[model samples]
Target: MKRKINCETARNFSIVKALEKLGHFPKKSNEKEAWFLSPFRSETQASFKVSKTKNRWYDHGEGIGGNVIDLVCKVLTCSIKEALSFLNGDTLFFSFQQQQNLLKKETGIDIIKVQEIEHPALIQYLNSRGISVSIANTYCKEVWYLYKASEFFTIGLKNDKGGWELRNKIFKNSSSPKSYTYIQNNNKQLIILEGMFDLLSFAIMEDVLLNTSDILVLNSISFIKDIEKFIHKYIIVHLYLDNDSAGKKATQYLMNKYEHVIDKSSSYRNYKDLNDVLSYENRKEI
Candidate 1:
């Protein structure tokens, strides 16, 4: 019989331990809260706070708060079942029934195979995505046979699970599937984009303008709720959302809520998005 999953076991999974593994040692701790750098965004201040006593979290910067499981779910971007399985150590190995037929399917061997950096297939995949091998090398790495019997690959980032965050890769056409990307600079100024392409396009434009401002890709417009608090914390925020109806709605909603925040992209009313205008004007300089 299949074993039943346990929630208590999953809840016992330590948020503190996981954050430590992510290289975020809590800077402040009392009986109730533990403060640390925002794990979702690059920031100098400690805005991501965990409530040790209540086993909850509140990211003052992003304004997202929930229980430990919520943090795990957001960080790993996995479903509840997957998160529980991960905590139960089921992710690392297969069951006995699988072991019986493992050799016939080569499942055991594939599971143990180590991913190489210069794999031909991986290199080709990256190139096909309109991303350079060097860029992929800098931001990501290939994983071998991580999933089941298949040779799965993923991009490496600071976050533990190396799955593709779907942020700025040209190969990832739409942000529908949901991915995460973070952009920041020394300056207090910050900008958030709705998609990976938008972020890349913004980065290119920022480079041309010699602007040192920070940028972030929400990967999905829905993540707007996730980072609403972070937006308020910043002294100056430029909303460069897409000019589509949904984007317009989101922009208007935020503007009405936060009058002080600037909507920079409102100036580009003619273009559907920053990328469209950049591409339209023959602005290859970006």
Candidate 2:
């Protein structure tokens, strides 16, 4: 037998649990209220709020208030019936639970040390990639980490979830949670990157990025679906993806779906990605 839930049942469901399926969680919470970064737009502050006692939500940024069903309709862009179907569906329930399990404690990662990015080997590695040491230092940390029972030092880029994306001349991995690294701004413009290296490359190549526009480093292409909700709010979105097949398909899908989406891959038309372009340009100067 199948359990069919009505809109009445959904109206009383928990918005916090509903949002968990959409990857929206409270930045701060208590017994009364839970505050979150607005799923409707990109902003530094947490403007969307949920009332634990009442099981209702209010997005102060967007001036919207509703129950769980309405919240689902707004966030997922689905109609009432569609939203109801999703609320009653098993797929989202399992995904929400799986995400919770994956993010549980974010254990297995041990930080042996953290220091300034000034080591000669690390500095030399940055220079070889044409990255400015000072710029890299602002976004990256020197980390001595343990993985697979072995210890190694690497350049670490912190994700929005407080997990570090660890990279070096050889080792490339991330602490648990594996979330996106969001550089937030109030600007209507948005730039998306596949990795932190590309973000560092953008900072070096473009002089206007002194926190002027919002940027998101997905860290992995698998994050595309997770970040898609935040992308539509941008008036203009520049996709700085690689020249490879996967990047091409992603860029194409995004461009076709959103009129504001633009492929900026042509800037690095001859290279694999923006980092490669930066390296090639730097080599030309040598």
Candidate 3:
């Protein structure tokens, strides 16, 4: 058991805002009720309900309901004691609200500068993942942006849809109007990857093969439905995705929808993903 010093405060804190941090923004909401997709599981329909009047939540899918503390425990997979410690520390709560407010107040990602990928720190970071400078330079640009009044730089991969997928050692974020990166040439064959790093890993492994077809890097799985129409245009579609539950679900989703869709995760079956596979291979070679 743990002390209840912050229990009451944590209980009454905005569950809505907290859920937003968990990427569970409500699909529909009124003064009393907010409904969202069950963040705990993969589902198309929204089943998670948040009651502002009661300041509690019920994931109808999970058949369970509780206050903010309970929700945090479930999200973090931690104990009530651990949850309380986390809440008292005020990391998630304060940080989330601050970030949310910043988004509302600011215009969007403010590009301070765009440069070549020559920063030694960034190069070292890429080297660890088996991505060479030349390969990264071809597809990625070094971008410095301001978010929430803090200046940061990352390797930015511009998507076809006029937004950037930003990444670095400390942070991972995509610019507004998120969409997949499509390296298109031939529409006959399509290679679908979950993230930019995976796409980069694939490019490094098989650069010649990459040019032979179009590549679609989802950037985030939220764009899965958005890319349905585009995927149909390709005669052959190869999926290289993470082996986790969401990835497995996405793989199955594509398989059921399209006849040509193929899961190519066998190469990295033992590892987490393509990047993992590439890094491990590089280590073995050394």
Candidate 4:
């Protein structure tokens, strides 16, 4: 059995080493202290610091500081018990890696062309995700884009801002000016979804040859606040979110803020989301 280490012992553990283990190397360092980029938020300058001698850490941006345990809690966003278990090797913690932000990438995607969905590879990709070619053709387009001077293509779903959400077998990205996608059908009842694929999956599952209600694809949960203006008038709002903590929290937030908000995630509670269930069911049939 793994042994438990108390807070005092965990505190004395080298903060510099712990930060390094979490894939956060110091930008500047001396014998007494080291400065690092804040893991909590992205910035060009290093504002997070670890004291080598005192064995403590601080984030200038957040104005928070504490021992290694506190640092772990902040980094993992977990409780003390969870952090202790994580540090004890009882739970595996994946080292955090900085992801390239599509909105802020230096070599932003340049759309070379946009046309009908005809790529065999893209059709296979959609089929792999249990999305039929007819559904994809109806809702998406084939987009050829240039990134880092290399040509690439993917399935594109257009948003309200004219930007495209790009997805393929390997990479998922979006053009700048990202925003949600809404399809209004003059219906009082609205269906809300996290992504376009979820709506397509729901259509396939329900055999929705004709859309009976208005559709709103948030595209990203960050755009959830923007929904208030569009959703306030709807008599009933159906939420089809992922079966995850963030999804559940967003579901609750909408339910608390609006009337006739129904969570339909229970239909796919055993899976991650609507598309996940569709993919799994497709796999089961084969």
Candidate 5:
């Protein structure tokens, strides 16, 4: 029989619990109200509020609000059915347990049992991506996998999914379609990039230049909407979007709508992205 979905079942999957799952916590809580750091933007202040009685959330910074499901949908960027399936712990859809078990049996290795990384190959993979070994170590971990009864290792980025976005040595692959690194300073300025490699390349090039600017990598251009509110909040936004036609279109679209956002594409007009520029001789030295 097809089970029914209801608001009661949905509300049981609390917005508070979902935010907590995403490493966000309420700054203050009482019987009625819960205050939290804005999950939509990088902010030290607690601007996101939840009414426990109503099971509703409001982001004062972004001026967005709704029920618990709305919060989950926004955070995961998934549809109502997807969010419901996730909340229900549906084994067929987005089950982390199933994925972990599958990863374990296929690799003949337990992912959780894998010890601390001391792998040089993983380090080299980060280096190839223009990410320094130290920076990679700060944000990611080396993971050993058993796939098809073969043992292999990959560099994995910790994601909201609680799954590692694995980048294998042979293919340079990522498990998630979204592969962007995010960094926020004091939240006054914002810098946006397209991909992980481009973000790393930009970091290498503008390490000293980016002091207080928050960095966001879109992973995919589709995630751009996720950060739109943040873009509106900040005073200055430096868009280092890719040099490709799609990138140009996105940049132009954003520039037309946003007054504070600046297109920094003139500098990389000849290259496809930051990594392409960084790959050349004498480019790495800069």
Candidate 6:
């Protein structure tokens, strides 16, 4: 029998989880609350807040605040029933476990173990994204994590701060101490990218090794400001960000702020991002 979902049950869902599902990951988070860039509008600073204790969200930019249901309605621009249905769809595995021990261990998700990328499912996921197994094993790791009290695995890319950008077919998340991944080659040229997949896609398309250039994966666009201090050091900065409004805005900002900054997004203008172009090309050959 199908379980019935009402406003009461729907409101119990985690607002932070929903925002992450919508691609609005946290800029910073603690036990009590998490901050994210407003999903309603693009801004440099994160003004959206999700209170983990209250299970509610407040968008300072919009001057509005509400519960999970209200957040879903606003984000999807849908009716109450539709919002309930949406919440119900993922309710079974909907975990908002605030266990004190888990929180102390890691902010949101818990890392069980990390090994070389060898899982068949993970391999398939990499192939689907046009990343070869050899390249994946060379760069990424098979990270098995505990979420909702269940073990799941994904291709994990480590950042400078020792956090992991966890991604698979269905789930996309990051561990605590969220920071950018900088692969320094001690070279004068630097290439900037958005996600781990973008870095892998660039490697595949350009056929270059990690030491070819100093690479910086922002992991999230919100971290762009954090990289400002050292970004100017590179003689040439190539940005292969997504072909979206935020990406364009960031590219323009960098170009205006520094010399030798180049927008490499034009190469994949027709696609959403570098990974999208690679995925499309891979599909063509199949």
lDDT winner: 6
What lDDT score is found at residue 257 in candidate 2? Answer: 88
Ten contiguous residues minimizing lDDT sum, candidate 3: 97-106
Output the better candidate (1/4) by TM-score.
4
lDDT of 1 by residue, 183-226 (tens): 55665777867754455455556654326666666655556666
Off by over 4 Å in 5: 1-118, 128-130, 146-150, 160-164, 176-181, 282-286
Question: CA lDDT, every prediction?
Answer: 0.54, 0.75, 0.75, 0.75, 0.64, 0.77
Q: Output the TM-score of candidate 6.
A: 0.68
Tell me the TM-score of each prediction against the true structure.
0.44, 0.61, 0.65, 0.65, 0.53, 0.68
Query: Candidate 3, which segments miss by more than 4 Å at Cα?
Result: 1-107, 148-150
Better of 3 and 5 by lDDT: 3
Model 1 TM? 0.44
Clashes per candidate (backbone, < 3 Å): 3, 0, 0, 0, 2, 0
Q: Which residue pairs does candidate 5 place in steric collision?
A: 107-146, 107-147
Give the higher-TM-score candidate: 1 or 6. 6
Model 6 per-residue lDDT at 5: 75
Query: What is the lDDT for 42 in model 3?
Result: 33
- Tens-digit lDDT string for candidate 6 (65-114): 99988887766546788668666664332222121112212337768999
User: Among these predicted structures, which one has the highest TM-score?
Assistant: 6
lDDT of 5 at 241: 78
In candidate 3, which residue pairs clash? none
lDDT, candidate 2, residue 265?
A: 93
